[model samples]
Target: MTTITHRLPQKRHLVTDLPGPRSAELTERRRSSVPTAVGSAAPVYAVDADGGIIVDVDGNSLIDLASGIAVTGVGASNPAVAEAVATQAHHFTHTCFMVSPYEGYVAVAEKLNEITPGDHDKRTALFNSGAEAVENAIKIARLATGRSAVVAFDHAYHGRTNLTMALTAKSIPYKHNFGPFAPEVYRMPMSYPFRDDTGVDGVAAAERAIGMIDKQITADSLAAVIVEPIQGEGGFIVPAPGFLPTLAAWCRENGVVFIADEVQSGFCRTGDWFACEHEGVIPDLITMAKGIAGGMPLSAVTGRTELMEAVHPGGLGGTYGGNPVACAAALAAIEQMSSLDLNARARQIGEIALAALSSAAESLADQGHGVIGEVRGRGAMVAVELVKPGTTEPDPELAKAAAAHAFSRGVVVLTCGTYGNILRLLPPLVIDDDLLREALDIVIEAQTPA
Candidate 1:
């Protein structure tokens, strides 16, 4: 397949005030028609997006650093993905893989099995969302191990489904009143270097969590230990070095299935095919989504063949799982990743972003504006934590203000973290270097207080 370049000028341009007239009208319509529960980062409504730029309804072009929350790593409206979806839709939109299997579904499964970590024989089951993939992975673990308990980490985000909500660490928007929550799920302390008051290294931190698990939810009764290799919505928290390897090793010793939730960190988003690769940890079950299908709604649970096959036939599937159009998009996206060497591109983006953010953080600290706590992440996934000046106390207000400032200036950035004090950048791996630098400059300016 030939590479298709973005057509829009790769620069940010503002034609009207942030929302403009059209977007403001739509926002009003949304107030009455759509629920207030569904929130959007940008006030403007997007009409077209490609490469690293989003064109809003009033033709205001905004630099896209959020990547649709890391869904469009190859770029939103990727021509190759669009072509694949069009061709597949023309042939047949959906027969429901359960009713009548198609090559596209099987092809996606085959590709997932080949790409996900581990050389051991593996199998993949598809789903419609990351939550669905995570839910199924838990089901498979429970059935295979005949255990009832599961372990999750503090500040980890699995998904929003019942089981996943229970797995998720945050409580406000995700689990506040929504849950009586699923039982048999336990949370352990994560190895957060920035917030670790104990000052433990990766291996020691792993021991702390392991000790808690052994005492609280004994390994024998644990079905699986699920964690995001790099926690996404929980603030792009990359675990300390040796942390993942230690946890995986303990899981192996105890016979508990180890699951890596790579939903936001998979498919070359983190400089590797999966974030787990950075730590050299092979999970028994790996859940994937987001970048898998180039913005299509598709997710997968890929794992050891023995564990996956243990489930009875017809035990795993859904109505829209692996839709043909989505599968075709996945195939095209994977091909694009390999052919374009997006993994290397992600590394390049990471280097540039890390250097810029780190410098900004240092400069801010020198200027006595210590609100920029720490800048951390890998590959194209980067973030800056905000804290009160001269203290470790979280400053969520500062984060919100910075993001709003960026949006006002025609750049699309996002905020995350349990305390809501992290400004994250997830620009498309295919973004132009100059455009990325310009967007980062805006972000840095936003971080600086007047």
Candidate 2:
């Protein structure tokens, strides 16, 4: 197939093996300098990336379906975002918001407040990462409500920080041996419609969870209830239809601050500015990162004015909470997203990918090797869970093999899920339709049994 011409040419071309000689050499050098703990699925050294392609040092072009873990919604090297970063770097790089406030910081905060769900008076606090934003959100909630316990759902991946680690439910790589973690965080059942054998609806899921919370944790003792609108690292699990709204309503009635951790699903990745908007669920606070700055390190906690104001001025800031360059990039990224209407593009991508994947799954199922257990997601964030042919048992080996096969064919795919049986696709929102379809085809072909 001919490569589509773009910034880096949206195409997949294998000049050599998957981790060609150049990448292998770099990997050897990296082993000596970088920690073994920091791992990556795509074992290649990227020299240039743009649109939907990541070019390695060996001249291999790989279709990017992961989008740098959903960071580059506009694109990996979006012209506007790159220009903004370079321009800001030329003027000034640091000058942290707490040390010397800049217009860029305030402007980005304003944009976040305006775009996040709800028109009620809200405030924004910038942070360096999703973990920091989540930690601060808990701090604010605890202070405002004078409560100790916070509720997090199962199959949740908040972050890796101490508090977030406590909130996260994974055990192997994320939370394993990282304890003793932060205290007073409780875990509850999530509304995973796909895995729910009882066939519970959205409202039923919410009621079941609320019953547990009421029985275990008293209303006045809880500080907040935090959840991902669409659980990202936890298999891209999308809660049932009415689950989020029901939970948000319960939180409001009980005065527990409701927080939507949109780190992975925000910024038009899930067809909406924020995933919570899909169900009209208005949270007291929203934690954002990943796609906020077009791949730059920036995050935020935007919330109701009253809850935010409850925190003292000096109580909620870090040294580099809102670096000038990052804030500038965020402003440009938001402008680019709005101008390009990336939200609609995300929805379009979802429609095409979902239909194709559903059809493929059905065909494979008829063949008696029904590996795809479920295909779920919204917008550009989609996933295919691999399971045993005749049972619901997770097949991590099959998922791993499919991802490896796609990578060998010059398509970058990411595997995730608590059981490591999910293949997630998060192509850049600005990806060309042809390239997107081509990448999806490669993945589907890889999953087919020999």
Candidate 3:
């Protein structure tokens, strides 16, 4: 229960293979200066990481189960978030908290309004990513509920700008060809209990997603509903336990500003620092960003100090919004995730990754190698989902050949959903439970499907 030992070497070594030879010469100098629309699901080149490995540059150590996408939950080089981002980058690294102002951006907006999930009189702001804290939490819920239609669900993603890619619902590589996106933005239906076939519960999947948000928008023209209280990339989808307190009690009886989007399941990575606090469901605007700054480029929103003072003090900010060295690496990664409770180490890494991926999906459907249709998640945000054996369809090339054979046997694993077929995982709430059960036995021997 003390795990934070760093400086690499946790195990799983490998040596020279998966993009080896100095990461294939930096992936051929990152394919002549990056941008084949910037891919990289892992073709290895890291160089060095910590807690749960990641070395690379052909040296090869691997084993980090995708925490970078969940933003290094107090790991990748976290010596108290690299000495608070090297003492806030030797004094100053950007005076821009909307042009000169700091105290590490008001102590990271008083630590995201005293650690998120409602006490009531909350308020925050800070942003830089999670699509600028979800386009400023739909501009403070359409300027404190004057309303203008917003909703968003069905395999939702909610980021990649242009009003979070029109509140993302996936269109190959996050709304491909970007498109005529930012409009009124409506989409619903999501209580995905392993591909919902109508045996509904969770308040009948929140009354069939509030009957498609009251027949597609007009609970007085919405304003904000934006979810993801455990639906990252939509495959780690955990909806049905009274579907987010009956869609947050019908967005608090139609005033509509629910907005969770705890960007990749907020700090402590889902073992409840906020996955809408496992159904206590408070969100009246949350939208944080990948583990709030252990991997900088911070983001936030918080809310309900009358909907974050309903905009207009120079109508919300940005000029590197709140960058005093990413609010001193998010106040030293939220004081090393609340002095390393890391939300009970993300429910003990989600009860050992849901009992080792539910016993490797019941031993790969009793050796029929059924392509694991589900595994689900909670703390330490897990996933699995490949499908098509007895047919739940999706198998994204067997989840990209079981994450390229668990990154050629060293273990890195990431993949996601909206039919990319979800591998997920997101380790590092201070990893090392025997190197996370030997990287979940090399992701159940490289994603089963033989």
TM-score of 2: 0.98
Each model's backbone clash number: 0, 0, 1
**Tens digit of lDDT per residue, candidate 2, span 1-450?**
112245776777888998999999999999999999999999999999999999999999999999899999888888888999999999999886787888998899899989999999999999999999999999999999999999999999999999999999999899899899999998999998889857699999989989998989988899999999999989999999999999999999999999999999999999899999999999999999999999999999999999999988799988888988899889999998898888989999999999999999999999997999999899999999999997889999999999999999999999999899999999988889988899999999999987
Of the candidates shown, which would achieve the greatest lDDT relative to the real structure?
A: 1
Q: Model 1, range 188-285, lDDT digits (tens) per residue? A: 99889998866698898899999999889888999999999899999889889999999999999989999999999999999999999997899999
List the candidates ranked by TM-score, beginning with the highest. 1, 2, 3
What TM-score does candidate 1 get on C-alpha atoms? 0.99
Score each candidate by Cα lDDT: 0.93, 0.92, 0.84
Per-model TM against the reference: 0.99, 0.98, 0.39
Model 2 accuracy (lDDT, Cα): 0.92
Q: Give the C-alpha lDDT of model 3.
A: 0.84
